[model samples]
Target: MKLLSVNVSKPKTIAYDGKSVTSGIFKESVAGRVMVRKLNLEGDGQADLTVHGGVDKAVYVYDLASYHYWERELGRADLAYGQFGENLTVEGLPDDQVHIGDVFRIGEALLEVSQPRVPCFKLEIKMEMPGFSRQFLASGRLGFYFRVLEEGMVGAGDTIERVKPGPEQMSVRETAHLLYFDYDNLDRLHRALRIPALSQGWRDAFAELIGTSEGAPKKPRAAARAWQGFRTFVVDKKVPESRDITSFYIIPEDRVPLPVYLPGQYLTFKLAIPGWPRPVIRTYSLSDGPCHEGYYRVTIKREPPPVDPSIASGSHYFHDQVEPGARLSVAAPRGDFYLDPAEETPVVLLSGGVGLTPMISMLNAIVHVGKTRPVWFVHGTRNGLHHAMCKHMRQLAAENDNVRVHICYSRPRPDDIKGLDYDSSGHVSVKLLKRLLPNREMDFFLCGPPPFMKSLFQDLRAWGVPEGRIRYELFGPASLLTEGTRIPLRKPKPASGAADFEVVFLKSGVTARWDPDYDNLLDFAEDQGIFPEFDCRSGICQTCMHELLEGEVDYVVEPLDPPYPGRVLLCCARPRTDLVIDV
Candidate 1:
């Protein structure tokens, strides 16, 4: 056996579908000897640590036979020695013959087989074949990943020698096949579990299979969607919460038990206006808790006129057009921002203005669940005139020993009392939070206007609160927040269809798979945790116009006027093919 080449590379970011994808998969061969470490070879690094780069999968070894096979299969002869992103390219140790726990020596380095190289999306990108990962796995010619048992200098053209054979004699190909394809092979599963050199992740998979075959417990699943498409619901009652904000309680028209949802989740509605050509869609937070099973409540504030006429507000239609006894097209409740009622961690619910909607839901759910987690409900508004649910907020704190309510009136009215109206006088700042909070080690949930959310997020991080703990949902674009937050609003909505189509947001550096659930690109981008600002969602305003960088799009809603040259109105556009939009 011989080592053909030694490959090394650092993580590199490249444009893919208009988004940036970083990977260490683009490896190039090294010239001279290099030091082999426990984690990786010299000058090599993995972009994401969760899946790649560890003591076990330290050095990936791909044999030339598999390269030859792929070259023939793909009808391409330009494949390089490090094409498969392997660190060490070799002539021997074909996957079918290389056994797990087998020891090998190349130059002065000693290594042991730990696992088969599981191809990720990076491999598909590397191979330039969209479904190559599945094809590679099914082909059963996957190369092996080895862990450094002894670190030493190794160079290209070094001779490879098998030091010891694995005790079980389970080949890499057989192990991979047994785990991914041979679910019914109980004996092989048992034998594979006994091999000590196999990675723990592989062991867990085999154990899961063994348990599944023997009637063991399965893992829990995520909360699922309640209904498909749209269902009609009647507005049973409307109550004024504040000067402008009103709460509407809507019950399912079928009078069935509504699907349970966690606190902080929002509901989308399709509103039919008098003169609009299409239905106006709006998303509102469920202001009430899940404990109220009979009806869902949305507290909406009547919005003033926008600076742009086409950016006409939806709240105006709700306040003026819709009323009790009106039927509305309601969709399944969905939003990634939510409070897990069962979690015992202390939480701080922070909000400003109408942002109090989701906070109210969370506070109610927390109290209803009866868990002893400490909660600090902090709210800010101009004064008593603008604040909603004052009595309820005070009552929740008065009744619950663990719950603390702190209200801040940014500009309190002359008539508003000192302690009775609000507990604090300024905006809800990190300095204010420090005074109210006992320590800095609690989960913080914030919602409000963009400025309010952004400042608080930056302040919290600066004060040493981990980003993971500082959860928030903003009123505007996720672009308003700093980079690396992955859209502070919520997690990207999962793709609805198996469609291979992808929309790349160039400025946002995000790629969203097309979901047929959305009628236009604007809604699809929003669902995928992208923030493309739009005032009129029906393509009348031209507010959501973005450059069409790479692909063609079809108009779902015809614009009021012709679009700009080379620009598409996202609110009216649906991707006709794979798209790259200059956001």
Candidate 2:
């Protein structure tokens, strides 16, 4: 289906003169006709079938291109009007056509149509234009939630393409109504539940609806016999230089066997703090290699200004408030950044301040495994006093002739030299890097603050390091790093001669014919208004995880997780054969 129109509008609250519009005015404002692609509706009440708080009060809607065509031709803006909380407004296409598991690629970014929009009371106020909410209920043209699938720059006029389509018989709108009005509708709910396209929040809610009264079925008692309890042990070590950062040695209570992990992988720990709304899960990189017995080390740096002020002091809360005896819920180690032991080329490990954690792990792995590859470790810190793991790093270097460590200090105190060796009195610069190596064949592993990372990357490029050899880690929100630099958009290549393929949506029992050159299963789904939940279209985030019920596919890039035995990341995965997908 070709796009007919794209519209966007920013939501604005209007207060009437002495009328004091409460819910009604908000509803009336929601009904206004605006030609905008994104519309943010505002109100303050519970909307039916909303995931986040205030979502019910502030509804956003988008009209599809097909709907937009009708709206434009008939000059019927109300058909696209609704009190549903919508941050985006679109015209054209049947609302039911968008499915929960589908992803819409707009510009360089992607958005998954997570769930259907739920109308709020504010519509009654905005509906002042006419019978807006009633018309919306009658027309069944509600908008849906778009979980950002891929993050990048976005604006109006950008084309939208579906990367994955939901099963045909079950529509997102149908699922929304089923969830909103009749959550107990077992038959429809069962069908929606089987689609796998549903969001995790909706899935939990559905599970609660169906199985809440009775606790989740218990595992066989025999299964419990296999459970090994965890063992706990603690070893405290000082950083020598940085007192604010400490490394803790961990010993599990059950003494259960822990799996070996890649050097740069992180472990997620779920902590329950008193007075907190829910258990908080945080991930920290393993600061050392898997060693003899069951011990792993993690370094904690005091956060200067904790993002959540409720915690009083950021790092202090994690350090002083948290106790060693507290049980921590843990996730298995996961990461894609690892040193390739087989590459005989010289390797360079770069880090700044607390970014040294993963680099230390890599260095430890290299030393422990007795790899003979030449390694150059370059570390940058605010000053020698702020440098962490100084003693341990120096000891490792002293023991290994193949390893060399260079420390750069931005600001140095005369007495700070007591605990540091191989120290440089200035910031790391391309000139210094050139002076140190003079050669450019090393595989660079760099991680640090955004600015340091950016400057280092630029210098690496100028030094002619191949794109494939340079790998880095993003410690925070992927959005924090400027876009268009890390991963450049691939220019759409001219279609190779078309090849016929079939995509079987297993749940729907429908097979769609596709041309390899013209159809990307994901994009085609969005064009037909199907949206799948996804993030990091580059296959970094495991958001768009899906199983391959049948057939083969080739991934455009390496995925974060080893492709689940039978699954592929739909965002970057392409069919290598006639395919059957579970979603």
> What's the lDDT for all of these models?
0.81, 0.58
Which pairs, if any, clash in model 1? Answer: none
**Model 2 lDDT tens row, 1-583:** 3222223233344554334433322222233332222212223232222323332112234565535654664466775333233344444435677776676775555555656654433454554432244345435566666665444544344556776776645766687566544443567766777766566666656665555223333111112112222223333232323757776666443333333455776655555655677655455677886443345677778767767555434245457665555445555555556664434679889888788888888888777757788888899887655778787888888899988888988887777773364378777766788888859888888887888877777677767777568778864333333344554212334544344567777755566765454324565444334466664454555567778888988765444345678887876677888888887
- Residue-by-residue lDDT tens digits, candidate 1, 24-73: 99999999999999999999999989778899999999999998898889
Each candidate's clash count: 0, 59
- Weakest ten-residue segment in model 1 by summed lDDT: 216-225
**Model 1 deviation from native, Cα RMSD in Å:** 22.3
Candidate 2 positional error at 515, Å? 14
Candidate 2 displacement at residue 237 in angstroms: 7.5
